[model samples]
Target: THIFGKFKFQSKQGSIEDYELGDLIGKGAYGEVFQAVHKETGKNYAIKVYDRYQMTQANKLKSINNEIKIIRRLDHPNLVKLFSVHETVTNIYLVMELVTGVPLSDYIKQK
Candidate 1:
């Protein structure tokens, strides 16, 4: 989906020089996801920023680490591709391919 204008999602780290973040697309218990573009390549991607503070309380760091490991191993059309991960002292940034489609809840309601 195309979101116009600038919107800042919460990031533990100040700002990286490489990416320009746009509107937020999704949020979960752990963190928020935003639409981002790379400065050099001009490639669009979904940037998932995980809140270390929240995740630590839930003891989910290992699970998140495992998920990253599995995602790195994947290579298929049906699976979402993970590009790269950026690690900070307080947050984990997962750079993934942006997939455009309706949410399952919305699709079910339509049906």
Candidate 2:
């Protein structure tokens, strides 16, 4: 499934049973970011799904993995928290804290 010039594909290995995926909130080179709700806790999170094919093509798999490792060790109030990680044969899901604030560029422009 392709949406707005972005490729949308389902994961074959990961189970999304715990998450109720909502609208496509954002898009990037690797994949799309979806607003997801945890079924058990009713907590909202931003699930960034990275397509395996795209990551491989960009040679970003190792970089992404390294990023995850670094994020897992972070506990700062300013940083978006990394809650969990889910991997599929076709995609990787990064469950992250949903932060609300003005974009840096927008803030700069206003100033």
Which candidate ranks first by TM-score, i.e. highest? 1
User: Which residue ranges in model 2 land beyond 4 Å of their true spot?
Assistant: 1-15
Across residues 6-101, which tens digit of lDDT does each residue of candidate 1 receive?
212233422344789998999998999999998888989889999877888999887888888899898999887887666665777878888778
lDDT of 2 by residue, 1-111 (tens): 222112113334234568999988788888998889988889898899989899889998888878888998989998989876776667878888876567566799999
The lDDT for every candidate, in the order shown, is: 0.75, 0.76
TM-score of model 1 relative to the true fold?
0.79
User: What global local distance difference test value does model 2 have?
Assistant: 0.76
Q: Per-prediction TM-score, please?
A: 0.79, 0.78
TM-score of predicted structure 2: 0.78
Find the 10 residues in a row with the least total lDDT in model 2: 1-10
Best by lDDT: 2
